[model samples]
Target chain A: MNAVFQVNNLNKSFGGLTVANGISLSMEQGDRVALIGPNGAGKTTFINLVTGHMPPDSGSVALRGADITRLGPTARVRKGLVRSFQVTRLFSDMTPAEHVALAVLQRTGRSGRVFGNFGAMPDVMAEVSEGLKALGIDHIANHKVSEIAYGQQRLLEIALALALKPNVLLLDEPAAGVPQSDTSRIEEALAGLPDDLAVLMIDHDMDLVFRFARRVVVLAAGTIIFDGTPQDVAKDARVREAYLGNYANARSSV
Target chain B: MAIQRAIAAEGKVDAGPNWLLRDLMGLAAVLAVAGIGYLLFPNNLALLTRITAIALLVLSLDLVTGYCGIATLGHAALFGSGAYAAGIAAVHFDITDPFAMAAVGAVGGAAAGLLAGAIMLRGRGLAQLVLSIAIVYLFHETANKASNWTGGSDGLAGISPDPVFGIFGFDLWGRTAYVFGIAILAVVFVLLRLLVRSPFGMLCRGIREDPVRVSAMGASVNGTLLRMYAISGAVAGLGGALNAISTQVVGLDSLSFTTSAEALVMLVVGGTGSLFGALVGTLTFMWFEDFVSAINPFHWLTIIGALLIAVVLFAPNGLYGTATQLLHRVWNKR
Candidate 1:
C-alpha cells in the first residue's frame, strides 16, 4: 500500500470560518477511501485543497511522495491527479464524444496544431471511443451532454477525467443524488479501477462508501475523527457519535 | 480519437448537405457584387475598402467573444493601437506602405493583447470583461494625452498607404484601393476559416464551455486564452492599418466605445461561431448604418437598437447559426 497522496497539518479558511483544520492523512495508491462528514465539515473543501482547487492556508499535499502544496489543479492532474465536480460539469451542448475528445487532445497535446491538419489524425477518435467504452457510455457518444441522465453525466465526467489517464482520481460524492438502482453499478465501477490507481472520495452514502472503501476517514468539524479500515471505522465510538443517528451508524456498519 | 477524427475529417457539419457549397457560393456572389461595384462605383471604392477593413476587425472580435467565449467590449483599444502604430510609422518614419503598416500594427496589437491576456485570463467571466473594459479606457486615455503623435481629436492625418507594386497610386476613384483590400480580405478570411474549423478551434470552443474541465485535462486556460487574445488583437490591428490606408486618415473614432459596441452587435447579429458570421455581421451592420443614416441620421440609432433586440429574441444563436439551425429543424421535420 504505497501512499500516493499524503496530507499533513492542513488548514483552510474562507474569511475566518475554518473549512479544513489541521487535517492529516495518507491515502495509498488504489486505496478507496471515503472521506465522510457532515455537510460543511469541509469534506469538499479538503478534497479541493488536495486537488489544488484552492491553495491551503498552511500545509503540504504530497503526490507520489512529492509535495504539491502550491500546484494548480491542472498542473496537479498532469502529475497523475484528476477530479470531477460535485455538480455535473459536462458541456451541455457538446456531444459526449466531443467532451472526451477535448480531454484526450489536451493530454496528447494535439490541440495546438493548425485546424487544417488535425481532423485527419486517425488515433484521436479511437481514444475518445475507448474512453467512452471503458466508462460504459459509448452508446451515448452522439448524445449531447445535456441529454444524458444524471447518473450517466456522472459517468461521462468520470470518463473525461479518465481520458487524462491520471494516477490519482478524486471523486466528490460519486453517488450523491444518484438513484438507488444505480448505486451498485457506480460502486462496482469505482471498485474496479486499476489497483495502482488511487481514489479518494467524499460521499455521504455510508452504505456505498462501506462497500467500496477499504479504508475510511470520518471527518467532523473540519477534522478527522477516525482513520481506519471500513470495519474499524464502523466500530469507532466517535464515528457513531458524530453520525448521531441510528440509521446512519447502521448504514456505515453494513 | 480515431472515430471523432473521422467525423471531423469529412468536414461534415450537422448543418446539413450543401451548406459549404451554399456558403462558398454566397461568398463568391457577395464578393463578385463587390468586385463589380469596384468597377462601377469606383467613386465609392474607398468605402468598400473601409468595409473590408472592418470585416477583419470584426473577425478579431469573433475570435475573443465567439471562439474563446470571453465577451469583450474593449476591443476598440486594440484597433486604435493598431491604427496608431501605422499612424506613427507614416508620420515618423515616412513608412506608409500598407504591408509595412500592417506589420507594425499587428505587432502593436498583439503586444497589447498578450499583456491584457495575462492580466485578465485568471480573473474569469465578469472580472475579465471589466478588466478588459478598464484596459481599453486606460489606453484611450493614453492616446488622448499623447497628442504629439496621434493628433488628438484631429487624429493622425496626411498618412497615405502607398499602393503596392509602386507603379500605381491610390486613385481618387479607389480602383487600386479596392484591389489591395480585396486581396488582403481573401487571405485573412481563408486563414481564419481554417483556424476556426481545426482542433485548436474545437479546443477554444471547449475552453468557452468549461475552462475548469479544460484545465483539469491539462489545457492551460491562461495560455490558450492569452494566445487567442493576441491573435484577435492582431487581426484588429490589421484592420486598423488597412483603414488608415484606404481613408488616408486616422481618427479618435477608432478608439471610441461605439466602435467596440457596433462590432460586437454585428457579431451577435451575424453569429459568433462562424467566421462567415463575423463577415456577415460586419457587412450587414455597415450596410444598415449607411442606409439608415442616409434616410434619417438620428433615427438610425433606434433602428439599429431595435434590430439587436429582434436578433436576441428571434435568433438567440444569431443570424448564421440560427439560419442553419432552422434549416436543420425543417429538414428533420420533413
Candidate 2:
C-alpha cells in the first residue's frame, strides 16, 4: 500500500511534559485507522502537528510524498490535508448550507472572488447540498448552526471536512459530544465515505473505534504501544494493561 | 491546479440577482432627499452636500469596521489625508480638475490605508483599536507639523477646483457642488453594494464571524482584510476630496480625534455591516444635529447624546439593520 500520508519521528512538548515523543505513523489511500489512547496521551496534539495546527518540535509530515511539515494550516488544507475539530468550530450565525457552501467555495478556489452571489453558483450549490446530504443533515441545511442540536452540529462538523474533498482527512473526534442515539448516524455517514479517501480518526469510544477501524493503533504516555488489526489491539496484553482494559469496562456500562 | 482552473473560469460570472437594485434604491432615497432639500430649503443645500460627503466617510468606515470586524477609531486619518492631497494638488500642482483631485485623494487615502492596515492588523481587539487611534494621531501631528505643505493648524487654503468636466462651476448656491457630491456618492454606493454581496464579501463576513475558521478554509484572512482596508480608504478619500472641492478649504478638524469618533458613532448608530445603514446613520445624525443646534446651540450636544442613548437602548442592531431584519422576518412569514 502506498502511503498517502506519512508522519516521521514527530516530537513536541509543553514545558517539561512531553506530549508527542518521537511519534511516527503512515496511512495509505483508502486506509481507515483509529488512534485510541488514554486521556493526555497527546492524540489531539499529534493530530495538530500533522495538520499544521502546531509545529512539531522535530519531524516531517508528507502528503502524496511531498513534504508539508513547514506549511501553515490553511496551506496544508489547500494541499488536500484537512481536519475537523475536537469541539465543533463553526460560524454560530450561519446555516449548515452556508457553512458547507463556504467550504465548497474554498474548495473551488472561488472564495476570493469579489463579485457573484455564492448561493447562485449551481456547481457550488450542488456540491454543498451533496455534502450536507452525505452527513444526513440536508433537512436542516437552511437552519442556523447554533439553532441545531449538538448531535447535528457534530455531524455538520464532519460535513464541513467532507466538503473540502481532502485526500487525507483527520477527524479529531467525530462523536465526542454527540448523544448515544446519534452515534449511528455519524457512523453511517462515515461508513459512506469513498473507498479511496484516507481517514485517521482520534476517538476514545473503543466500541465505535473497534467497529469502525479495520486497524487500530494504541498510544500510551505519548508513545505508540501497538499497531495492528483491531482484534489484535483488543487482545494485546500491553494495550489491555495500558488502556483497553479500562475502556472495555466503560464500554460495557455504556 | 484544478482549483486554480475553476477560479479562473468561474470568477467572472454574474453574481446572482441585482445587488445594484438595492444600492440604487439607497441612491434614489438620497437623491430624493436632496431634491426635497433643494425645494424646501434652497439655502441649506451646502449643509446637505456636506452630509453627502460625510455619508461617504461613514460608508467607508462600515466596510472595515462593520463588515470585516476591524475595530478602528482612526479612519479620519484616511479622510484627512485625502482632503490634504486634493488641496495640495489644486494649490501647488495646479491639478484643479475635480475628477483628477478625487483620484489624487483616492491614491493618498489608499496609501494611508496600506500604512494603517500594516500597523493595525498586527493585533486584534483592544490592541488593534489602540494602534489604529495612535496611527490617526501620528498622521494628524505629521499634517500639523508640515506647516508649508498642509497650511499647518491654520488649515489648508488658497485652493480652487476647475469646473467639473470643464462645465458645471461650483456655484455659490452649491447647485453644481450638490449634484457633484450626490453623483460621487451614488457611484461609490453602487460599487460598494456589488463588492459586499460578492464572493470576496462573503469571505470577509466569514472572517468577521471567525478568522481562525476562515484561515483553516485555506484563505489568507489578513491579506483579504488589508485589501478591504485599502478599498475603504479610497472611498473615504473620495468623500474628503469632495469636501475640499466644495468648501475650497481643508481643516485640522478633518484629522481630529472627534472626526474619527463621530464617524464611528455614525456607523454604529446606522448599524455596522449594511451599506444603507451607513447612509441612514450619517444623514440622521448630521440633520438632527443641525436642527437641534439651530434650536438651542448651547444644549444641542445634550440632545444628541440622549438620541444616541435611545438608539442603543431601543434599536440594538442600529436603525437600518433592525429594519432590514424586520423586513426579512415579514417576507419569510409570507
Candidate 3:
C-alpha cells in the first residue's frame, strides 16, 4: 500500500538546539499514529516542518508522493494538509458555526466571494452543521467562541480541520488543557473521524495514545527512537529508557 | 436529530427575516438622517457635502485599519490619488462626466491601494504604520514636485464636471452637490454592508482576529488584505471624486498627512470595524468641530480633546459600538 503522507530526512535546528534530526516517517490511508515523546522531544517541531509552518534545514515532505517541501503553510493546507494548534486558537468573537463555515468556504475556494452571506448558502451551512455535529459541538454552534468552554473550543478546532476535507490531519495536543472530564469527548471525536483519513496526533496522555493509536512513534531528543505497533512499543528498551520509562513497564506487567 | 438541532440553532441566531429587517432599518436611518440634514441645514449644504465626502474617506479607512486590523495612518494616500486622478482626467483627458470622473477616481484609488498594500503588507503593526506614514509623504511630495499637473502647492482648479445626466448644474447654492453626495454615500453604504457580511468579509474578520490561524485555514493573508485595500481605495476614491466635483477643486491638502491623521481620528471616535460607526463618527466629529470652532475658535481643540478622552474612558468601543452593545443587552433582556 502507498503512503498518503511522507516525510524524508527532515532536519531542523535552532542554533545549537536541534528540534528535528533526520526524521523519516510515512503513513498509509486510515493510519492512526500517536507521536509520543519526552519534554522538548521535537514532536510539535516535526509537525511544523511537515505542515510547512517552519522550514526544514534538510528534508523533503510529500503528500501522496507529491513533493511539498517548499510550499508555504497556506499552500500546504490547500493541498489537503490541515493542522490544529496545541493550544486552542479560535476567533474569540466568532461562533462555532462561523468558524466551521469559514473552513468549508476556504476548502471549496468560495471564501473570496465579495457578495452573499455564508449563512444564506445552504450547501456551505449544511457542511458546517455536519462538521460541528460530528464533533458534538452543534449545540454550541451559535455561541461565541469566548462564551464556549475550552473543551468545546478544542472540539471546534478539530471540526475546523475536518471542514477543510483534509486527507491527512495533524492534531497538535487537541486536548492539552482540557479537563479530565472533557477528554472523553475529544477521544470520541477522534474516533469519529473518517476511517480513510490518516491522522497523526501529538499527545501526552498515555491512555489516549494507547486507546486511539494502532501504531505508536516515539521521539527522543529530536530523533525517532521507536516506531511499531502499540503492543510492542511498551516492550522497546530504547523507548522505555527515553520516554515511557516505568509507565511502559507498568503497562506491560498488567 | 443532530441536523435538526443544528438547523434550529442557526434559526435562533440568524433568521433570514431578522437580517433583512436590520438592513432595511439601517438604510432607513441613514436616509432619515440625510432628510433631516436637508431640512435643518439647507443653507449649510456645502458643509454637509464636505461631511459626506470625508465620511466616505473614514469608511474606507475602516476597511483596512478596522476590518483587516492593518495599522495604517496614511489612508489619505488613496483619497488624494482619487482626487488627483479625477482632476487630471477632467483637465487633461476632458472626462468631465461626473460618473466617468468617479470611475476614474475609483480606478486611481484602487491602483494606489495595490501599491500601498504591496509595501505596507510586508511588515505588520508598528512597521506597517510607519510605512504607511512614509507612503503618504511620498505621494504628497510627488504631487508637489509634479507642479504642472497637480498645480503644486497652489492646488488644482478648473474641474468643471458636466452636471448629473447634464440636467442639474452644480449650482453655487450646492443643492445638487448635497443630494448627489447623499445618493452616492447611500449606495456605497449598502454595497459595503453586503461586502462586510459576505464570505470574504468573514475571512477578513478572521484575519483580523488571528492571521496565523486564517493562513492555517488555507487563506493567503497578504492576498486577502491586498484585495480589501484595493476595495477600500475604490470607496475612498469615489468620495474624493465627489469632493472634486462638488467643490470643483483638488488641492495638495487632499493628500496631506493631516488628512490621513484626521480620518484615523474620526474612525476611532466613531468606532472601528463598524460601517455605521464610521459615518456616525465622521458626522459627529466634523459637526462638533464646526460648531465648537465657530463658538470658541481658540479653545476648540481643548474641548475636542476632552470629548475624545471622555469617549475613550466611558465608551472604549466608540459611541456607536457601545450604543449597539447596550441595545443588544436590552434586547436580550426582553
Pick the TM-score winner: 3
Instruction: List candidate 3 segments past 4 Å from native.
Output: A244-254, B1-14
lDDT of 3: 0.90
What DockQ do the predictions score, one after another? 0.46, 0.42, 0.60
- On the 0 to 100 scale, the lDDT of residue B269 in model 3 is 88
Q: Evaluate candidate 3 and give its CAPRI docking class based on DockQ.
A: medium
- Candidates' lDDT values, in order? 0.79, 0.86, 0.90
After TM-score superposition, the amount by which residue A242's alpha carbon in candidate 3 deviates from its true location, in angstroms, is: 1.2
Q: Candidate 2 has which clashing residue pairs, if any?
A: A116-B15
Each candidate's root-mean-square deviation in Å? 3.8, 4.4, 3.2
Q: Which candidate is the best by lDDT?
A: 3
lDDT (Cα, 0-100) at B207 in candidate 2: 93
Question: Which of the two candidates, 1 or 3, achieves a greater lDDT against the reference?
Answer: 3
Per-residue lDDT for B138-230 in model 2, tens only?
Answer: 999999999899999999998888888799998798888888998899889878888887778878888998998888778889999999999
**lDDT of model 2 at residue A49?**
87
lDDT of 2 at B316: 88
- lDDT for B167 in candidate 3 is 99
Model 1: CAPRI class: acceptable
